[model samples]
Every structure is written in structure tokens, then in C-alpha cells.
Target chain A: MTYDWTLWIVFILIGLATTLPRGSFIILGERASLPEGLQKALRYAPAAALAAIVVPDVVLVGGVVEVLNPKLAAAFAAVLATQVSRNPWLPFIVGMGVLLGLRHFL
Target chain B: MSPSFREGAREGFRVFLPLSVGLIPWALVTGMTMGGVGFTPLQAMGMNVIVFAGTAQLGTLPLIAAGSPVWLIVVTAFVLNLRFIIFSAALARGFHGVPRAERWLAGHLLTDGVFATCLEKMLSHEDPRWRLGYYLAPSLWSWLLWQVFAFCGVMAAGSIPKSWSLEFMATIALIVLLVPMARLRPMLLAALTGGTLAVLLRGMPLRLGVIVAIIGGIAAGFAAERWQGAAR
Candidate 1:
């Protein structure tokens, strides 16, 4: 377990940054109207952010795109599962199940 | 203090309960990973309480382990959480009428799930007070569950074997949660674009690839929306 003064400083900085996003508008209250283009752009943030996190996890191996792997297989399977069943749990279950099965049996 | 508040709280909790199922695995993984990476229980708990952003926390852990400079770690966390800035701005409308202190507290507790749920509820409900309660209930619930599950993970760290591939399970959870959010064409475009580019640019240093992918996806979505508007 690593501990030092830097951890606390980094923690505080990240904490403040995290809070700023959630608190800024709420605190300002009356003076918060983003421009139309920016607003439209921001609407896409969630999907973009999620993709930014997920794609690399599945497709990239050690910073390089790997074509053959169980992780990629599971990611594709998850996408198909979502298409077949709108149930959110289905993709996760199917993907994890596929990954486990592939790892164990194949 | 009122019936509306009570009802709103209940509904908020109810709405959040389903979404939280997806996050539980990730929370556990976070705790396990924290412990695995040599973070003391105290550090893990502090991160769970203060940082509260899973993606950012996950991103920062590796850098911290690498003994990266404090500035770099801070930058990474900030960029990963940049989405929250947009979330907060969007949330302003929903929480416009709420008091200052509550609003600030709400911001501290805000998560992606709560923001989405609250936005949906705000669209459906006209009452401000109920909306506040609705938003607060789930935010608090999520915060509580995150802490509890993460603590459990830290405690059970060595007990859980690595071969379980728990890390992959967390990834699956994220994928499942994200795929549903792509119902609209613009959203679908954004996800595809971001996902594709993220893979293509995975080699980029400092995880800047994620930031690049996000910006590209947003731009692509914006273009698609504009084209659809023009066509319509």
C-alpha cells in the first residue's frame, strides 16, 4: 500500500474538478445558458464518453489493435445481445458468459 | 417534509435501483483492483468517497501505480471526468429552482446514471420539488451502494481469485450500460465513431486516445444531427 503527501494533493485536486461539473450550474443558478451549438455537442457527450472507455478495453491489447482475442469476441457478442434483447442485463450476461466459456472451453 | 418529497424519494430510489445492477460489478472490481495495486484500504476508501468518478478513478490508478507525476495524474482524472461538466450544465435546468446548498450537494453526488434518470424525470414532471427529491434519492442511493460494494471488494481482495476474470465482467457491464443509451441515430453514430476511433488510436500515449475519440464522436454526432435536420 503506497501512501504519501502527493496522494492527498492529487485526491483534493481531482475531487474539486469532479465537483465543479456537478455544482457549477447549480450554484450559479440563474446565469447558466450554453450556446446552441455547444448544447447540441454536449448532448453527445455520454455516448462518446462510454465509447471512449469501452472500445479500447475490448479492441486494443497493450495499445495495439488485436484482431484475434476473447475480449473482442465478447464485445461483439455483447453488441449482438443488445440488438436482440433490449434488456440491459442480457448483453452483460451474454458477454461475460461468452468470455468465460471461450476461456474455459476453447 | 411533504408527501411529494416522500413520493419523489421513493420513485427516485426505484428508478435508480435497476440501473445500479449494472454498476455493482464495476464497483467490486474497483475495490479489488485498488487493493491489488497496493493502495491501502484508507486510500481506496478516500478515493471512493472523494473522487467518486469510476472511469477517472480507474484511469488514475494505473498512473499512480506507475509513479507518474502528480500533475499528470491530475490531468488524466480531469480529462476523464470532463463529461461531468457537460452533465452539470445540462442538470442546471432540472435543478434550477432548488436551493443553493442542496444544489451543491446534488452536484457532489451526481453520477452518470442519476443525471440520465433525473433528466428523463424532469422532462416528464413539472413539479420542481419532486424533481429535486427524485434526483437526490438515486444519487444518494448510488453513492451508498458504491461505497458498500467497493469496501467489500477491498476486504475480499485476496479471497477472490484473478482467474474469475472479474475485470472483464466489469467491461461487459459498461458495454451493456452503454449500448442501451444508443437508441437514437445521433447517439448510435457517436458511439460507433468513438468506439472505432478509440481502437484505432489506442497506441496514443497518456490515454489521450480516449479524449480524442470523445471529441471526434461528439463532432460526428453533431454533424449527423445537423444533416438530419437539413434533410427533414
Candidate 2:
């Protein structure tokens, strides 16, 4: 329960985090001109950040990097599944299936 | 609620519904993963509804779990959502001379999908009223789906099996989002270099490797873009 306050504070701060940037232009669109270099960096940051997050989750098991892991195999399988289907859920479905199947068998 | 605004809003909802439907899986997964983080279901709901950012909300969870400094959590979320700056700027520029209220509201509602949809539609023929209505209408529809689905997930979270590791679904979803971007050379470089560095630096305390990876990835991508430009 002690963490409740912290969580609440986070909610408010996050709300600002989202609203502020999104509204940055509306409030100052006429005067605000993001640098061309900044824009390019922003374009690539999300993919990179997502990659960072996803890499550790799948490649590392309990902190140490493990070669033989269900998550790792599932990730590769997910890439293949996505290539084959236009279905939005195909990657998740195939990846999870592989993960569970491998976990059960191995 | 002028006739023009109402008509535009109707069209907007029709246009954005298909994309909003795609958000369902992501919304539910976010809710479930949030619940699995040991927060109460109410807290989970609050995070989704109040923050109203899927990526930032999910990205900040590790910091919250680790009991990282409050400032760090806020800064991380802000960095994670930096794309909104580009999105909002482009969106706002197109709405030149729109009413102040509508402009502000549109900015608040400027989501990734909404920004893209708004840009694709030629709303300039219509007045600011219609444009504002069009933006608000679809956003309302999307927000409703986000809340309803996320709420359902949080409620059902208790009965969900823990051993299944449903939280991993968030990672898988992110992977799905990332894979298509790999087709772009600069993006591929960023992801590969960033992801590898993250693994190498995973030992960073308070999960600070994420921030480092993001910066490194952006630098690599910038360098790649400049290199490609020079080569051409």
C-alpha cells in the first residue's frame, strides 16, 4: 500500500508525459520547429527502444544470456509466421504456440 | 455538432474503426501484463485510462517494479513517447487557423493512428468545426474500445493461469510491431545494434540499459541515414 502513492504520482506524471509532447505543437505550433536531425532521431528511437526491450526478454533467461531457450526460438518462429500471414495476430499466436509447445516438450 | 461536423465525424468513425479494431489485441495484452506486475486491478485500470499511452505505459512498468526514482520513470516515459513530437507537429501544422478549442482538443487526442488517419483525410475542405468533430469522433470510438477491452482483461486477470506467463505476450506483441520495420535499412541497423547493446548491458541497475539502448540505437540509425545519403 505504501507504493500506492508512488503509483498515483506516476499516473499523473505519465499523463503529462503523453499530453505535453502531443500538445507541444498545438500550444506552440507556429513557433516550434523541430530540428531535422531531431526528427530523424525520433523516427528511429521507437523501433530501437522496442528492440532493446524485446531483446532482453527473449534472449535472456533470469539475467544470464541463455542459448537454448523457448523464448528465443519463439521469436525466430514469430518472424517467419508474420512473413507468411497478413493476419495481425499471426505473430503472437505462432510465437506463443511455439513457446508453449517447446516448454512442454523440452 | 453542426451538420458538417456531424457528417465529418460519422465519416471519421467509419474510417478509423478498422484500425481501432486492430488495437484490441494490444489493449488487452497491455492490461493483462500490467495486472501481472503485482498491482491491483484498479491500479492497472488507472494506469491505462489515465496515462492513455500504450508504449509508454508498458515501458515504464519495469521502472515502477524496480522502485526506480519517480523522476526517472517520468523521464523514461517522456523519452519513449518522443515520437509524439513529430506526430503532433505535423498534425498541428495542417490545422492552421482552426479554432483554439478544437486545436487544443485535437492535440490532446493526437495518437499515432489518429494522426495518420487525420493526415490521410482531406478535411481542409471543411471548416474547423467539422475537422475537430472528425478527429474527436474516431478518438472516442477508439478510446471506448481501449477502455472496455483493457478493463475486461484486468477483471479476468485473476482467473488467468499464472504459469502461462501471459505477460510475455507484451514482448511478443512488440516483436511483431518491430519485425515489419526491419525492412528499412536504417531501422534494421538501429534495432540490431540497439538490441545487441541492450543484451550486453543488461546488468545495468534500475533497468537503465533501456535508455542507453534507445540512445545508442538512435545514434546508429542517424549515422546509417547519413552514410546512406552520402553514398547516394
Candidate 3:
């Protein structure tokens, strides 16, 4: 397919928008503090945002909501690993292994 | 310089190692999605090099597939990535003492996972360079893995089965990573609020509901923290 300049432009703009905030703050360097309330809120934002994104995706399959999907099961396994070991790598590897194995069986 | 250039480079490599595993699947999925959407391997690789953000790239792929207006796709992607504004602000505070050049370079490497990991490390270690080390180590790994795995996906695009449910794997990976971080009540509240709001608002057009869910979650978290502080 031929290149679309518009798509390229959009991609660049999106990239810019994404990077700007991170860069701007670093470049600006301590001119201000995040409002205390917002700072506190920021702490939770990632976990919340990530959970919001991940939960539904893992639970829903083929228009049916089932948390028992292999993906969710693997995720639960990973969570358990994380809780027990607190080792980031172990849980990920174990989860991936479980998912890969289940994928084969299913 | 807050961290010697050598130190920064070392930090970056260290950050890159552990994160490579998690990023591999994500990057592979992204490349596969891009290729499935009909992007050439070159285009997909270029996107990885330049855009570098996973969700925004994934978000824009559908628009490209649908032959949507380029400007609209770009705008939507920009909107989707607005979260970095908060991340940037937080990081700016932490790296305030660093020189402009170093700060700018670090900013280029800033990412959600990196920022979160770095912030947590900084909370425990007072030395800014140590925090930089912690942040750069995983982040560098993630970046390299994303590029390599994405390239593999793009090259083997047709061979990769759609049934693999790689996206599902990515979601599971994120959930696994996030569970360890949700240690506080405010954090828990935010997660619950965001998840509920996202489901409630899932039907909204243009994925605006996701944004709303994010804002709601953040607000709820802030409120919870404030209330707890007041109680204390």
C-alpha cells in the first residue's frame, strides 16, 4: 500500500503528545510540585488505569464474560506468584508458561 | 549532571534487562497488529522506533485499518496518551536537580512502566542517580525488547495465527505487574472505581469512556487519600 502522509502526520503528532508531558516535566525541572492531592492521586492512577484496561480484556471472550478463561487463570496464577515471591520475573515467566500450555490444550 | 552520562547509560541497560520478557509479548502483539492492519514491516518498525508507545500505537492501528482520516487518528492517539502529562509532572519533580540535557534524554525514555517503577524506587532511595538507575534499567530493556519482538512479528505477520490471543497475554501480563503495586487503600479504590466506570462507560463512542474512567479513578483515589489524611 502507498504511504499516507496523513497517517504519518497523525503518528508523529501522537508520539509528540505522548512524549511531551514526560519530557516537559523533566525539562522544566522542579519549577513546581504536583498539587498534593493530585500527587497522592497519581500514586494510584497506574494501578487503577491498568486494572481498568486489563480486567475486561482478560475476562471477556467471544462476547461472553468469563473470568475463567485461560488468560484470566494465568493472570491469577501470576498474581499469586507476585504476592508470594514478590519477584517480577518469576510470575511473568510462570504466567506465560501457564498460558502457553493452556493455549496448546485449548 | 544528576547522573553521569556513563551512569545513565548503565542505568538504562539495567532497566532494560528485567523488562525485556514482559515487553516481548507486548511488542510482538503490536507488530502483529500493525502487520495485520496491512502495514509493511518497514512502516511497523518505523512506528516502533518513533512512536514507541504501545497503547497509542495499538489504538491507532484500527484507525489505519479502517482508512480513517489521518488527522483524526493522530488526534485520537494524542488524546489516548494524555496520561503522560501526569507522569511527566511527577518525574520532573523527582529529577529537578538534573541538568537540562540529562533531563531531556531521560524524558525521551520515560514510559508508564518505567515511571512507576522509578517512582517507587525513588521513594525508598534518596539518591536521584540510584532512582535513575532503577528507572533506566527496566525501561531500556523494555525498549529493546519491543523493537526486536515487534520486528519479528512484522516479518512473520502472515504466519502468526490470529487465534493466539496475544492481546490476552498482554492484558494478563499487565494485570500481573499491577497487582503488586496496589498496596494502598487509595490505590485499591482507584482500581475498583476505574474498572467499574470503564465497564459502565464501555459503550461510549471514540473510547472516551476510557478517558472518563481514568479521570474518575484518579479523582476517587485523590478523594480517598484526602479523606484518610483528614481522618488521621
For each candidate, the DockQ is 0.53, 0.65, 0.42
Tens digit of per-residue lDDT, candidate 3, span B68-164: 5555566545645556767777666667455677676677677777876567544565566755666666666777878899898787775756655
Off by over 4 Å in 2: A1-3, B66-72, B98-104
Q: What are the RMSDs of all candidates, in order?
A: 4.2, 2.3, 5.7
Q: What interface root-mean-square deviation (Å) does model 2 yield?
A: 2.2
By summed lDDT, the worst window of 10 consecutive residues in model 3 chain B runs over: B164-173
Off by over 4 Å in 1: A1-9, A83-94, A100-106, B1-40, B54-87, B90-99, B116-135, B203-207
- lDDT, model 3, position A103: 78
Best by TM-score: 2
TM-score quality measure for candidate 1: 0.76
Candidate achieving higher lDDT, 1 or 2: 2
**Residue A38 lDDT (model 2):** 86
> In model 3, which runs have C-alpha deviations exceeding 4 angstroms?
A1-10, A30-33, A61-71, A84-106, B1-40, B54-103, B111-146, B149-159
Write down the TM-score of every candidate: 0.76, 0.91, 0.67
lDDT by residue for model 1 over B68-152, one digit each (tens)?
Answer: 6676667656655666777777777777677888888888888888888788776577777888889888988888889999999
How well does candidate 2 match the true structure, expressed as C-alpha RMSD?
2.3
Q: How well is each residue in A9-106 modelled by candidate 3, as lDDT tens digits?
A: 66677778667766776777767556665556556656666766665556667635776777777887878887888554566567767887897999
Q: Which digits, one per residue and each the tens of the lDDT, describe model 1 over residues A1-106?
A: 4678678778888888677766777677658666778767877876786777677777767767787778889988988997888665577678878888888987
lDDT at position B230, candidate 1: 98
* lDDT of residue B23 for candidate 3: 68
